[model samples]
Target chain A: MTSLAGLIDRLEDAVAHRTPLEKEHVQAVFFLFPLMFFIVGFILMPVLGTLYDAFMRDVIFLEKEFIFFTNFRYLFSDPGFWNAVRFTLLFVLISVPLELAIGLMIALVMNETIPMRGLLRACVLIPWAIPAAVSGRVFELIYNYSYGAANWLLRVLHITTEPVNWLGSEIGAFIAVVAADAWKTTPFAAIILLAGLSAISEDLYNQARIDRAGFMTRFFKITLPLLKPVLVVTLLFRTIQALRVFDVIYVLTGGGPGGATEAVSNFAYKYFTAGDFGYGSAASVLLFVIALLLSLFYVKASRFGEA
Target chain B: MRGPDLHTIRRRVSGRLLILLCLPMLFACGRGDAETDLVFAVGGAPSELAAWEKVVRKFEADSGISVRLLRQPANSQQQLQGLMVAMKSKQQNPDVFLMDVAWVGLFSAAGWLVPLDNLDRTPFFGELLNRTDVYDGRLMAAPVYLDGGILYYRTDLLEKAGMTRPPETWRELAESAKKVQEQMRPENPGFFGFVWQGAQYEGLVVNFLEFAGASGGIQLQDETGGVRVALKANLKALRFMRDLIWEYEISPPSTYTEMQEEEVRTFFQSGNAMYERNWPYAWTLHQSDGSPVKGKVGIAPLPAPEGEKGVSTLGGYHIGVSKYSDRKADAKKFAAYVTSKEAQRMVVLELGWNPGRGDLYEDEALLERYPHFGEFKDIFRKARPRPVIPYYIQVSNVLQTYISGALARNRSPESALEHAQIEIDSLEQRYGRNPEGGGGQLSESFPYPSFTHGEAVP
Candidate 1:
């Protein structure tokens, strides 16, 4: 205790002698050190390790041997890997725009000053709040060929004479996967866009009203231009998330129906579980590179910083 | 006035930061237990886990050794993954665990399983033990239970169709299925003639093996692990499976899309089908008190092509001790206890599981309760396992894609098999043992001490 008291006394003297700017600099570095340590330990190290593993033969029953680019060579020629890539890209192309459009309308409705508006916003998030795996199982039941809601409703509405095989056919499996994913993730897009919508000043709408502008005209001329930055951010975020889609497809289709709905993530995970780490790592590294390139393109195309 | 409060807040924040930095150190050094209890990992349905718990308790009481029962995920895939992670990192706790029949090849080759030569192997089936449990000419695992594909037919429906016995050939089975379907369609629009596992999974491969007749499919050419998959028999079987869905129209379209073991079982139990192919466990469920098919189901060997004996795919869990266990002696004792005839009988009586021991088939009480045991003995004896190779899962994945693709009519069976054969060849070259002895480091050496029979416990 005496030694601690003496050290505190010496620290007070040192603090008094040092410039406040230097002390502030020390505190700033002290605060940032932990964050930097975590970033390096958790994120950076594993990624680099995976990059290293991709170039080695790391199967569980095999000896580790450094073989540069061999795994990538095999992966590129693999029809199953290509099939997964095509499915993932096609999924993003369809689901992203579908989600954005649905989310925009939802954001528009939730932005209105209505009764129990807060409750409505929270309720809109319920599907998003549920874990993707849980929701995927629910959707699996919903698409059941024998007694699912989709077929039952179709029969009731007289839309078709027979029950459509929703998860067995390639096209059916693709559609089911997209619909399930959009249902789970659209609310995230909506919440982000809702914040952007709320940030738009009421005065802008008031000015448009005074100018005798219609609602559509005001939205097109003012709202969309101002919302461009947020839209770009949401697109980039959702695109990255969609590229790495795994849990929902895993639970629902299991990359089944002849591998029609296998995404790149699921493809990589299969190899990993099968104890072929080198092949799995190579597949994942390819996905990471694609995600990085796409994000860069989005940023460059949108001129996000200037916006 | 604000300077003193701000100073204290800064101090508090720095103190918290220090704690945060030390947090990882705590976790890094956290596992300090001088743990002596044997950790046994097992996974199954809730009822199966409860049965395992009872068996564990009995062993603990008899041996005077405490045992920890670790419950893993019910899904076999997840269970394999959990064991892989623990074994790869070489955690010693999961001293003993249950392994799916398919994983024995990988686990044994990876040197994760401890040798068990001391235990008496007299009771277990010699063929199953040699096929799955033996590696490097040494015993590495012991069978805990057994499973095989069986033909389930509705007795009343067969009798109504003026048939006294189940069909014995694929052609006959198809004809009978169509005959019964035509008569039953008017009463139940949802009725079909047959159902089996055709979804893209491990079960699909097993069904294909059975369909390929007694020799099964995919021959391992030699010790170097060369595989031949595009065989004439496999093509015939694939075409017949596709015809069952489209040509004969005896099975539902969903057979290729969704039918698994449980799905096929439920369909047959609901009286929607005349013939069903599934595991032996489904019999108990089909004959349950409230079931629609109670006392109306009959079991037989799956039908094969002409002039060939029917084959069932061998499947079940095996108990093995981890090589890295700190408590191998105790773990081995537990393994022996689990595989002992008494424990096996208890498991069979309580859970309705097929006993891993062959002698149990002759037990009067068991046979009295389940007369079907007499029929299963021959089937189990002849059940052909999927190739017991280290990279069987990868090979199975490739097979799953192309086989289901053929069933789905995406390609001709010949072309699908051709492409699948090419993919599997490359996989074998990559994962198989290399001539230089640099790849597929199968544990061939045993420097570790082997257990001695009738040894005193320390």
Candidate 2:
């Protein structure tokens, strides 16, 4: 009877010990549940579904059939697909660095103790704040062949007698796209790099000044190296975003002049809009793979820079 | 380690957060299944939408059926995308909608449209009804309006050049344009000989078809949907189109890059072009009070190739009931009322639109209002439609690229058509109903491409 009573007492003690601990764990899980649900439901599931769809003949009005790698095979053979890839890659290679360079310059300008700095920052963000579609239309007007600002300026400056066909020729369209994209995205890069720029210790700069380091010397030695990590992150972010570009191109060019300016995402969207989901999914999956590889490369390079 | 009050507050906060997170899902799932009002979707310029709204109100008053007017974007492609989204998910709203004629093939094949067996299709243009709305031996939609490409010539410019009438052929048009452009250029530097839809969009395809002319024009071969774009007639048409931009220097360089119907019309209306190729709707706008060429504009059938008869491309909107619609009866009632002769007459009178109904063209009242209606009757009858296949959008996307490339002088006409043929062959193989029957080679005939689920393919 005494032993049985002792066992009952021990059981009560165990319950007392475990209840709060278990409660805490359960509460923690509850806190995380919403985030996990969103991640799984929206992002992970659609990505997996798209991956699965890439292997199927998922066209409208047709029986959905598993046609493994066939869509990808077709994509590889498609010249339009290759053109899109070439355009996207070239765009990234040119525009990303151009944005970073311009952004860094803007960040440095904003970092200085200049008058109306806050107002200047806000004004700079206006282009970035506007939706891409709206800004694309604005750029469309700016680049209009006949009476647009682009031509008006060129004529005023005596750059050419005739209006340069901005969205007509292949190279002209390419430059227009890059310039428009750079204008829209450079502010985002500037804001991020400004954060990095500010994070630098004032003491280091003071020491550099004491050591009589010139502006160029200080910028090369201190600013650039310190800004490297942030630059890599910004590069990865911009590259992924640029690879999936659709809205600006859709509004500005409609992938025109014989589709000289069509991006991979725009190409995929065409298929999706056409109800050829399998081919569209395959295109998206290829783009996704490209982005994944590029991000991975950026990650490795960042880690190397950190070391 | 927290006190009981703190723990309770944390739990309450988390509970509220969870509810907040679930709120969107709850609202998203709150679809009204017992909806009685028929949702009729139509898109156009604001004025056009307002006219449609009036039609819907009249439809409600006439049929005692309530319809919810769902306004769509003015851009046709954006409207198609929105409709595609709803149809893809099999949504019950948007019970009825206006479909671009080209989309009829895609929508019908996808089984998104309810077959209108009871619709009195005799009222609509018979050939158009068959070309655009019929699929699998059933009428899938009813026409709402008819649009066809026509030539808009500057009468004053022609009169100034001492040309009594508009050019009858491409050669004659060019000769007249060159003669007038030379005379007019010193005074008006912006003036050009011709303006057309040379931009890389659907209009380019329509213009190309018109240029190909009625004889041996580029068309879908059959239900199998094979197309021979590299045919001799198509080649000649493409070369002439390119020469107008680069060789003859008649059409502006921007024509290949920027011109669509609106751009072409505005350019011509602004007195920059001697001749313009555009749809019939532009006639009213060109003749509006403020237009520079208001009184000087004249209409004619689009000029054909030297030997072939000129034919405009068939374009219009068709209204159909959705297969997924819960209110199919109401939807059909509204559709019928909208396409009825009375409503068509209202559309013509109120909006200055071309009526889809065949009988409206014969109406004495409409004839008095729009004398061009007589000319339009002939153009509408002779109009050739774009390829009527499920994959036409995809096919157009391919052709838009190659043809625009050719016009931009990036490649020769021969190479452009050859490559386009190759690309289209593969598109057929991928999306064609019978892959084995329709791939690689451009053929003259293919049995109508029909979709049957899981029966044929291995």
Candidate 3:
């Protein structure tokens, strides 16, 4: 038979035994739980709200109804909605490739042993640092027919005799918006690609040079394959930023010289401000779904896992 | 290994309590503690802010109520969008709102404004009864100083262009623009003949309305207190504007995209524009001591096109009490003081507002303070308020968007006008009329169409 002390000792053993320290595991959970909650609260909440609002009837101020795909039906039926979607898609398709190419070229240039690399790096950031609203306002002046720098420069180059009201004409406005958006976002893409370029081991390039591999061959084979992951990340980030483009388009011509530049976000903002919370939410949902689909397609095409 | 649990339990308890306690503290933070402090709201423009801040100081001193004035920033759509955001706060929407006259119909229709007709029984009520404040025969809000658009021309430049007086017709104005462009701005290639608000917003509607009326297009006409839209006249006027930008190239293409009265003023002040179509505030600011255009400017009536009538868009704001205001009695006192004859004089003499009362403009002393007062004040008297229907805001947005698209997107003007007329008809049906419907109509001279049947267009 055990004594009273012995029984107390056993009880204390049951109560006082502690698990080993899991600093890494605890640290991971501490960081992850908050990040998980933030994703759910800020990003997911709005996204879910947008989805529900998309399908419901817009009964201003009342508890909205579940109309079972009516809003989507309306969205599909509207020409304006389709116009915005088509324009937005074309914009993404045109801009993404051009922006990506330019970004890579810029990254290559900056990565070289060139003089004034620091100045060039800082200069590259200038376009990205400018707020879209300010950029839009500034470019509007730059694109103005009478006073704008574009026409002045064009005149100097002897491109056209007459002033091109870049924002006044439909095609001019389209190209102008595309050019402006690309200029601002290319810097972001370049910075991302530059980071990827810097991470590459010097030994690999040296080995390739010893093997007498040409610059293009080396770039296409080793560098391209290795940079695939970073390129994917840059594409994902820039596409999302460009997909929901508003500030520049809104400020420049307000989706004018006749809605030529009305992105989905601009359309969403109009309804949102007009007190049509439901319609606005529906437009937002459409944007979200399109962005999601595009992201999924790009992620698959880029072979994120395989690469 | 054995570890301390008691401290852990204590920390856990405190953390849980802290989380629970945070919510009520947040709720408390949201509510106001100062019962005596009054917050006043106003839209910002240099002329108006200077005037309003002075009024705030004087009101706080006399009434012994501490007034906190918050000025709304100036940006297209985004600035106005901020006001809608502040409305979500149960504590914030100002006690006394400086409501834009254009938004008076909209905010009231949404039941955002507290009906002040029943709120007041003051001597100023008589004048209030006659104005646009009483929508559907309910006194929706109170009037502050009034605003109206007029032409600001370079007087010296006009005389130099061989025009002895202001152009009385659109043709003459265009001729004046061409003559002035040749005379003064030939060496300076960036200059424009005229600068006006042409963005797809309310200002565009107002600016377009003035041009339409001047071109013999009446946007709205009331016959026996019932309204009918004279769509043809409006179409003609819009076509003229389309021509003004496209064919004549008098008003720059940027005008088709510029959103506010201030932008026109900016271009004018820079000497980039020969004439500007803007509100009375710009005219006042130009005459101020520091103005670059102070001694260089002149005022004139917006000329008619062909054999049409001289008309300008009625532009200004109304000072209204919010529905959710806790201190209704105190707010009424402030409103009374603002719309009073003496207060109007203060605004006119100090800030250059064309007060709602017609008599204030006739005061010689007030006229002395504003040298160009005689012409702009004369222009204000002839100005017309926009279609006061609540749905007009929605309808106008459609009209302006399509019109802008036509000019910007290269769509036809005729089709855009036709589309607009049809859309407006549908919007008009949603409005509820007063018991004495069609009670008061301006004479048949104003000829905008009536929304007889609210039906969708093809």
Candidate 4:
């Protein structure tokens, strides 16, 4: 009976010790206030401000009043707004896949043993390293109908009979923008895949080779299955980038050749820069929503990268 | 010259290095950080910047104000954002800023500029320039050196083509260009027809307006003055531009959507263009020895369409004190000083800018010093403002959009103009204008590039 009581007492003591202490967590609480303020002030406040501004009646920032989604309601009828969305989606859908394919090819090349491979990897980064605006202007020069090196080279090589207007036609300008973007950004994907490739074991490839596997057989059986997480991660990163594509399109076309290249960002810029704060905010919020939805869809469609 | 030891040689070398280090300070470039600092911004190639640098030095010497010239975009939206940011940051360093005349209207409406009426204490800012800066009777931005569009032609090319005088009509111009371009010199594809700014902006409106004016189409009829029809003329003028690209093929169709100033000038300077429509700045820059057409270049009024009056709209940067500026007094002083007779003389003569004052143009002494003033003063008198409305930007945007479509996208000029008129009515309605300002009107003073319903005469 005493032994049983002693055991009960020990168990009761254990429960008593298990109870959490009531000591002040001063450090965490103290740091948390400013952090919360920062998040609210910088992030939440601007987001809400954009949302609030979108519904304003007048374009004049201070003069505006709550018109309650009149901007969006008007936006549905606006051809310019629709044109921007359609073109922006087209830019994303086309540019993203091309970039991914080009990126994967380059990544595969970099994965192979080659002379000065480190130097070659860095060289590939040169295009990606330059600022987007700078690259945009550079591409503008490249695509200039007159005195553009692109046409000059083509003419020199006898590839075409006449100087093709890269920016003159709607589809041509669209393709020019996509090509410039792909050229600027493919290295980002390459580097991501390179990291993924580095993690991939050569021993698995050796075993597959010993099993008399063909190139495709080895790739599908070994490399692709292992690299799925990294591939999805690289793809997600590229898609997010592709969705907000703006500067290159802006510098290349200025949404010209009759609004052929107008992106959501360009539309937002035209309004915001013109001080049409309300309309600009509506366009910007719409852009943000589109980007968010696309990102969420991509992350989900990649099956949380577990596939 | 004693044979120096290593120590002596090192000391001499160090002394020379010190002199080189102090050279900038000695030149006074380093001395004036806080001295009467003023910020003036302009946009152009580097050579143009050199002209403003001279203007700044003169201002510094005359007024004892240390000048900080901020060279940024002349017409970019970044300029507006930059000004707003500076105002918010409370930076008073740049005392004076440059603003385009059209931008002045928008900026003035925002009440961002100090009323020039308040600057009455200064003798430099006369009432005439100040009065024009006002919006709704409240004074804002002041006109600095103004700009008006002009046509530049290759004298040699025109003479070679046996057209003794420049074309006075669009048809004559196109006919002459087609003749000149077909007889391309054996060595080069010399003398293309024409070039002008055509991207969707204020520049395009000017091009559209000039043609419309020259075409005998009228926009706002001085109902009292008998057939006030400027906008209609503006559209007729635009159709001429369309015909030039699509019908004549004399003008570079590729340039219909180009928004560059220098690109057009380059073709003219390279002696590949017979006639080019550009601002006076192009004339100033093209007169240099580097231009193949320098000695043979001719500055003439733009061709009027079919016996109509030639009209050129005023284009320029204006100086204004910010309403939000704490240093409003200093800002007003700087504005007036820059526009003063003496400063005007220096600016015109040295910087190749046209002076706002007419008297200076005739001032024999000033003309003796600067000869171009005598030449351009006649042109300056004819400078007209675009339909000076608060919603002028909206008007121009619609006009430019339609014109670009008509010219570049191959839309018929008539269809484009008709579509533009409908768009203008809708835009005006959105602005809460009562269609015709409630005059039971035939038309709502549509400030678009004017066109006519009448068929093009064969």
The number of the candidate with the highest lDDT is 1
Which pairs, if any, clash in model 2? B223-B447, B223-B448, B223-B449, B224-B447, B224-B449
Put down candidate 4 lDDT per residue, A186-242, tens digits, no spaces: 999889888888899999989988999999998888877888878877877887778
Local accuracy of candidate 4 as per-residue lDDT tens digits, B308-421: 667676777777776555466766777777667776776676676766665676788777765766666666666666654445555565666667777776466766776666
Q: Would you list the rank order by lDDT, best first? A: 1, 2, 3, 4
TM-score of chain B of each: 0.89, 0.90, 0.81, 0.77
> Which lDDT values do the candidates have, in the order given?
0.85, 0.84, 0.70, 0.69
In candidate 2 chain A, what residue range of length 10 has the lowest lDDT sum? A10-19
TM-score of each: 0.90, 0.90, 0.83, 0.81
Ordered by DockQ, highest first, the candidates read: 1, 2, 3, 4
Q: Which scores higher on TM-score, 2 or 4? A: 2
Q: CAPRI verdict on model 4?
A: incorrect
lDDT of candidate 3 over A154-244, digit per residue (tens): 9999998667767777777788888888888898889999999989988999999999999998899788889989999998888888889
User: What TM-score does prediction 4 earn?
Assistant: 0.81
* CA shift of B114, model 4, Å: 2.3
Error of 2 at B165 (Å): 1.0
Q: Which has the higher lDDT value, candidate number 3 or candidate number 4?
A: 3
Better of 2 and 3 by lDDT: 2
Q: Is candidate 3 or candidate 4 better by TM-score?
A: 3
Q: Name the regions of candidate 3 deviating beyond 4 angstroms.
A: A1-18, A21-37, A52-74, A113-122, A152-163, A198-211, A304-307, B1-35, B118-131, B160-162, B183-186, B216-230, B258-260, B270-273, B288-296, B421-458
Instruction: State the DockQ of every prediction.
Output: 0.39, 0.34, 0.28, 0.09
Task: Estimate the TM-score for candidate 2.
Answer: 0.90
